[model samples]
Every structure is written in C-alpha cells, then in structure tokens.
Target: MGHMLWPFGTTWRPVRQRHRGTVDLRWLSARTWTRRWYPQGVDLGEWQGRRTLAVSWFRQKLDGTHLASRVAFVDLERSRHLDVLLAIDEDGMLQPAPIHAGGLAWFGDRLFVAATGRGIWEFDLSAIRRVRGAEARRVAGLSGRGVRASALVAVRTRVHPIDLRCSYLGRVFDADGTPLRRVLIGEYVTADSGRIAEYTIPETDEGRFEEQERFSPGLPRMQGAVRWGERHFVSQSDRMHPGALWTGRRDALERDRVPLPVGCEDLALDLDAKLLWSLGEHPWHRVVRGIPFRALGIDS
Candidate 1:
C-alpha cells in the first residue's frame, strides 16, 4: 500500500464524521492539500454528493487494429477500482474493443461515459451488483461480471472535425427535474499563438448538439468544466504555471480564479459538501485537490 501524502503542507486530521462507510476528506483552502494513490490510470474525475468516481483508459494495437482499449472505473469512496474492457463481436467471440472514455456523468442511477471523438456509453448502475472480496479483472475475459452497457449513443457535435475535441461530459437537472446532457468541448489549434476556448454544448438526446455557448472569462487551457446552479466552473492551466479553478456566471464573461497546487486534468463539484474537486496526473502519483465553495464567493 502507498502512503497518502499531504503535499500542500497542511496536516489532515480526521473529522470524526463518516458518510456510510467512507471517510470525509478535509482541506485548508483552495489548493491541492490532500493526495491519494490508486493503481489505475485516471485522466478525469467526477463527484456527486458523497461519491467520487475516477475514469481511466488504455489504448494499444491488437491484431491489425489500433482500437484495442478499455475503460477503468475507480470507486474512491470504497478504495476499489474496476476495469471494464471494451470488446466487439468478432465471429462469436467477444474481442477486445476500443472505447476511450474522456468524461463521466452520473445521473440518478445511470452512469454515462463519453468517448474522445466518438460516442457515449451509458451504464445502468442498478444492473451492476457489487462484487466483494475479489480482485479487479479485465471485463473482456469475465463471464459473469455485469458490465453490459444499457446503450451507446453517438454525439453529433456542431464543431468541425478539425476542432471537435471533447474535454468532459456531465448531466444536470432543471428546476422542474428535467435532465439534460451537457458537453464541455474545445479546440487548441496552434502551440505558440494557440488560445484555449471553452464552450458548453447542450443536448437533450444523443446524436445532436445545440447552439454552443462559448465562455469568455479570459482563462486559457481549459482541461475540464462543470456547472453549479447557474455558474460555470472550469479548470485551467498553462505551460509555465499550475492550473486553478475559475468560477463565473453562465450569462456573463467575468470570472474569479482560485489557485491550486497543480494543473487540473478534470473537475467535479461535491454538492453535499459544497466543495470543488480536481484531479491531477503525475508520473509517480495521482493527486486530488479540493476547494470550498465559499472560497469563490459562492454561498454554501
């Protein structure tokens, strides 16, 4: 087992409160104060209420095809990770397939994962029974493991093929309890003069995209995005500096930036705790950053 490191210099003390069987995470300010390690590769993360989910993928060449890949899910609250291998029907055998999930959305009892430039994979959480006391296995070889998808839908982004790079995907409900799929995508064309522009593409159904609303908060290099109430939050970073969390209104161009320990690859909001969460990648360890809502002038 790897030791948990408090990289930002603040000691983490137990809060004496636990949600279900998982312990609550603590932080001092808007920084990457706490760190933990998982044996899987995660490029993005999502948080809802008390649950935190991390997603990772593998891409390799198999046979003559370059589409051999799989998606891994890490249940941070339970300290467990599950690898769901992508497979296709070649003859009668289920051959390993490629499904590069870049974002994750957990709505109600459904889990939706979006592919890089392809489509979405919807999973029914109620259909998956927790497997205890067993180590994680690749889904391609498992017989009884419940990893079937409820549906796979294509995403018809309005951006051109040269500019259609999806950073993350999420779902939010309206005041009337109606659900909508919100996609955060953008393009970074050039290196020296390239500017990062983030936009929100809303779609109620699959295979279509609505009019995109571009964010003009002046923040560059958007790695992830999510919405809280009517506010839009994005994780930004540059080559010379670490990333930070920027909060602004959906209908305005102004924003407030909160500094973080490292550049974030993805962002999520824990509504129950009123905290903004971020995940960063390192060759040695995976880091998690937390910032309270009050830090960004938002009332909890």
Candidate 2:
C-alpha cells in the first residue's frame, strides 16, 4: 500500500488511529508484520460468536466457488498441505480447473465459482444431502485475456447483481449473465496506523526481483475478496498490503476513498475477523489486502 500514490518512504511508521489527513501503516523489512503471515477467510456458517475461516488448505483463489464434496471426496478436517506430489484425476473430468480457487462466495446455500477465465460454475449445498442434481453447471464464458484471467467478485447493488472482478480489462461485470456497466476504481488502503497507501509497479533491469531488493517499498496487489457489511475489503497477494484494508463505498467511491487496516474480504462479519480477506486479483497480483464495511461508511 505504501506504493499507492506517494511512497511512504523506507520504513512504515504507525500513526494516530484516527481519520485525519493521511492514514499511516507501520512499515518494516520482515514479512510477518504484513497481512500474508495471517490467513483470513469468511464464515460460511455460524458455529459460535467467532467467524471461523472455513479454510484449511492452499487458498489461491476466492471467486465465490467452493470445493464441493463429491461422492468420493476427502473431508476438510483431516486434510493438510501436500508439499509433495499430490494426485489429480487421471481422467481430469471431475474437477474443473478455474483461473483461481481462492475466490468464492456463499449465497443461499449455493456456492458460485468463477471457473476458468470465463465460466461461473455453481454448486448446490442447500442441505449437504446427496450432493447431487443440477449442481455443477457452467455459465457463459467471459471475454479478454488478463481481464478474464484475474479473479471474480459478485458485487450486490440495488440495481444489479454485479461481478466486481479484474483481468487486464479492469472492473467489468456480468449482470444476470449479461453485460451491464464498467467502472474503474482509484483503489487505496490504510496501514495499521491509518496511513494512506496506493499501488504502482515500475520497470527494472532484473524485472521485479532486483527492483524488489533495491526498493523494499513495492506496489500492493489484491488477491481474494468478499463484501464485509457494506464496504469491500481486499488482499494484495504476499505481504505488501496485508496489514491494511481498502474501502470504496457507493457514496465515498464517487467523492473520496476510505481505507482500513483489516485485510481480507471473505466475510460478512460474524467472527473476530470482521474484516474481509482478499483471494482473487481484482487489480493484479501482490500482497493480499483486507477491507472493512464500516470504513466505507456502510456501517452508518
């Protein structure tokens, strides 16, 4: 986030926790202090007061898709990261490969996944019964290369159920499976100290690696995401903007942008992680950032 607009210098300093001129995000060299070290996800259902991230595996996507339990699928509890070689279907017919797996959302017991670069695959989990019927159906294929390849987010507005995702084409939407409107966001985030931060990538001789070494202050990229309350929080890949969350409400979006320190977005606020965690690439790939609804004035 320090690379949003003006570079926040070398080190990030914590500031007064208030909505003043600029929000400060405590910066440093280590990656633990950022948002990546901490994994955040949404609560599909309620067990207690805390919203337990219904996640315990490699989370690389979050486009409203869920890993459904097939007739012969393993349980989520007794699973661990397969560092070694994991096996895929020899037929490659059961699991449809999407652009990302982290991007997901649960609405009315149904999980929708932006499968591949264009298709929005839907799965039924209304009762967890037989896990059958017309569940894994694919919608129409979207367009563009980078735009279709980034990630997907379903934005619910008064007018339409919009998809706020990014490929190289920026923020476009599939309204009821039809093309509607396109909007661009000057997205930004706030650090732990509420410092204003944005994103920017510069060219380097050794590409991003050498540049990253020279300038620790790199541009933040968003990963998985979901709507928290009214505002949308997002993650920016690794640890770049992990500690900070970005909010662009319906109203503030037209006037100004409000930032947050809660990275992540796969939530509607039922647990300690009231903030939302990012999964897909709304803008691009970087340290995943989180967002809160209150910061977007949705709480008001």
Tens digits of lDDT, candidate 1, 79-124: 3434444444445444434444455565544455555565445544
Identify the runs in model 2 with alpha carbons over 4 angstroms from their true place. Answer: 1-43, 46-52, 56-93, 96-99, 126-220, 224-230, 238-243, 250-268, 271-300
lDDT of 1 at 85: 45
Stretches > 4 Å off in candidate 1 = 1-52, 59-83, 86-100, 119-163, 173-183, 186-219, 250-257, 261-263
Error of 1 at 256 (Å): 4.2
For model 1, give the 10-residue run with minimal summed lDDT: 31-40
- Across 61-93, the per-residue lDDT of candidate 2 in tens digits comes to 245443221111111122111110011122432
Could you say which candidate leads in TM-score? 1
Candidate 1 lDDT (Cα, whole model)? 0.43
